[model samples]
Target: MLYPSNYVNKIIYRIKWVTQKNIEAVENKALKKEELKEKIRKNSSVNG
Candidate 1:
């Protein structure tokens, strides 16, 4: 079987795109968690 070069390039590019999206999702989730922790710390200090 034979495939076109553009077809193969498109597949590779899509794979990279998906991997990058997943990485960004993970980083965003981690960043949100850190922000939440900071907020909780600030609230606790104020409440005390």
Candidate 2:
């Protein structure tokens, strides 16, 4: 089956956009985890 060039381009663009979004989400999650750990460390230091 043959597809139009524009249709193929659209699919490629969408895949790229979704992949970039996924990467950003993973990075954000890691950052949040680090922030949570830092907060716990600060609280423990203050209490101890």
Best by TM-score: 2
Worst 10 residues of 1 by lDDT: 1-10
- Candidate 2, position 16, lDDT: 100
Q: Which stretches of candidate 1 lie over 4 Å from their true place?
A: none
Compose the digit string of candidate 1's lDDT tens values, residues 1-48: 889999999999999999999999999999999999999999999999
What TM-score would each prediction reach against the true structure? Answer: 0.87, 0.94
Measured with C-alpha atoms, the lDDT of residue 45 in candidate 1 is: 100
**How high a TM-score does candidate 2 get?**
0.94
Candidate with maximal lDDT: 2
